[model samples]
Target: MFNIAYRMLGSVAEAEDVVQDAFLRWHGADQSKIATPPAWLTKVVTNLCLTRLSSARARREQYVGPWLPEPVPTADGALGPLETVEQRELVSLGVLVVLERLTPPERAVFVLREAFGHQHREIAEILDIDEAHSRQLHSRARRHVADARKRFPADRARHEEIVRRFLDATLRGDVKGLEQFLADDVVSWADGGGKVTAARRPIVGKAKVLRYMLGFQRRPELKEISAEIAEINGQPAWVLSWNHMTAVFVAEMEGERVAALRAILNPDKLRAVTNWRPV
Candidate 1:
């Protein structure tokens, strides 16, 4: 249920609320009539998410800076049992960003078919739509996401090694080391949600990204902050906190090269991640 809600809303807090609301309904429901608990729960959760998406889209439009999905610690299946790479990819920050472009119904269909392996018939029943429409929505969604994607290195060890050096370069303000890890077309995004300071827009290209990272080392307060590496949003990421301000930095890689960076500095988004102990 949390998995469905998280994929729907992209905000952990909102997902939790939706799940809580679903449970509240279940508590009041006539237990004897719920012959299939899982199906009943799924139907309720799906409908609730549909209603929430209507409002969520509005909130996102007003969101400050580049809005990023709330990062969840995934090493322990904290976001649910992501037992396969395909499952992990379904919740990736990049995929979530792409998924945001899809309409709510379309997104729901996509998640159902791709992430959960739901058939058109089951999806139609769950969404109260016919099988034909379900298939249409799924096709539309697949095109939208497929058109915008990347090929990250499948090697987790190499990916982690690159991220480690990237962080080290930032701390040392090592321009050369930073550039080496970053791809030529690297892009960086920061989400402060107007509650904190962050890049108002994406910083693109290797040079600009290098400058932005090196700038971090100039801050004396950063030296007082502790950094930890953990699997966030299904990738090795940095969780840093200083002066009550917390942020998560995760990257996209091509082979051994860092291709993109996402920094979530919004305190609201950081709430779900507060308990994440870095590996």
Candidate 2:
């Protein structure tokens, strides 16, 4: 339950708060009256998450620049036990950006069902809604998310091979090579939240994305930037650093090409990298 809340909220401290609150709510309840403690905990935590999500959406709308999720890196570079390899990749910055298109309730239902494996009945209890309404929301959310995401076969090895090629191309500044691996209409987005410099708009089209990458590589200050491969979301990704500053890049692959690139450079968004050290 703690892991579930932590992943959902992206804050250990906040997850702790939610967990404690849930337990407190159940403290005096009759033990026999609750058939399933886990389900009850999940309900409490998820409802709390929905509340947080609502407030977060309001704050992000007024945010100074592009907004990105708080990155979470484990020792093994994967989301914790609760998440599968596929879910991790599907929840990357690119996917999360698409999720922003859905309404708050839609997002909640999607995450609860698709990401967390909750059934409509479980989700209904969690969100405090009727079963039918939960089913409707889940269906709507799934459709929106499916439309937004590519239909890539779930092949981890293939995904890693593509990512490795991407890293090689990036490190070598092989614009042509990189271009060959990008989709014709590739898009790239950066989120710095105005705390650091980043693209204010999405870089659309393969040609523009190629030019942007080339230009970024040519920056005089970038000569000092160091990069490493790390697990981001659930797939291999690049982590760049200069002095104490850090940035993370995760790619979305389509076939043998890159469909989208997500770069997270905001210092405030790199809190999870605070303890990260260059290799």
Worst 10 residues of 1 by lDDT: 147-156
TM-score of each: 0.94, 0.85
Q: Which candidate is the best by lDDT?
A: 1
Instruction: Report clash pairs, candidate 1.
Output: none
After the best TM-score superposition of candidate 2, give how far the Cα of residue 130 lies from its true spot, in angstroms: 1.5
Candidate number of the best TM-score: 1
lDDT, candidate 1, 52-164, per-residue tens: 98888898888889999999988888777766667777888888988998898999999889988889999999999999999999999988887334544556677787788
* TM-score of model number 2: 0.85
lDDT (Cα, tens digit) per residue for candidate 2, span 162-275:
888887787678987898889998989888888788888889999899888888877786778787777665666788888678888888877888888888887766766655
